[model samples]
Target: MDSVSPWLVILGMAVVTVSTRLIGYWVLGRYQLSSRTQSILEAVPASVLTAIIAPMVLATGLAETLAAIATLLIAWRLPTVVAIVCGVVVVVLMRNVF
Candidate 1:
């Protein structure tokens, strides 16, 4: 079996990552996007976030999901760093005791 050196692996990953970003930027810059396309692009971040969070929330069930929702609300209404800390604390406490 062949094993890759750690540096080689890291170098390969960096190359691939940069290439992907350059390709995306090149493609996007070449196009004159429609207003509808721009609107859709605006939703991309939220959609990607939802795609990531949805499955984890569903698998954890109602209590955890509710805790996360509350955390996000608190995070939104308060200072971002403080809100994140509070959310982490809540989730950890819930998991340990419940």
Candidate 2:
């Protein structure tokens, strides 16, 4: 069997993502969402981010776990980009020291 190209895979993924977003917007436009539902939808991004990162933090080594803790603390009070940069720095430093 011929192998699929990486560019093709990326293009397919992009198309799917855009199509899903557009379709969702179109569908949601037809409905009147309740305030509770709208609030829940607004929280989706943070929930998705936590779902993605929680497992990595819990399952990884001491360095990653420690870095995650530091990142969370920073994230509570700082801007997201700063927290991310600080997380990277902490992880790199922890990896070297531990």
Candidate 3:
């Protein structure tokens, strides 16, 4: 079998990642996007966030459920850092005190 260094494999993967992204941007830039397409693109980030969080929220216990809800509400109304800190505080207090 042929041998290759781990660093070389990492470098190759990074090159592939950058190349695919450049190709995708090159292709996408050629199009005149419709209003509907723009709207869909704007919603993609929120949809992806929900997809990632929904499963964790659903599988959590009471403290986690409350923490997640508090995080979401805080994040919606306040800064992301505040929301994250609040969530962590809630979880730590709940786990340690009760």
Backbone clashes, each candidate: 0, 0, 0
Candidate 2 lDDT over 1-98, as tens digits, reads 27999899999999999998899789888889999989988999999898998877988788999899898899999999999999999999999998
TM-score of model 2 (CA atoms): 0.69
* Candidate 2: worst-modelled 10 consecutive residues by lDDT: 1-10
- For 1-98, candidate 1 gives per-residue lDDT tens digits of 17879899899999999999899779888999999989999999999898998876767766577668877898777988887788777777777776
Ranking by lDDT: 2, 3, 1
Which structure is stronger by lDDT: 1 or 2?
2
lDDT of 3 at 91: 78
Q: TM-score each candidate.
A: 0.75, 0.69, 0.72
Each model's C-alpha lDDT?
0.82, 0.92, 0.85
Error of 3 at 33 (Å): 0.4
What C-alpha lDDT, on a 0 to 100 scale, does residue 47 get in candidate 2?
Answer: 96
TM value for model 3: 0.72
Model 2, residue 58: C-alpha shift (Å): 1.8
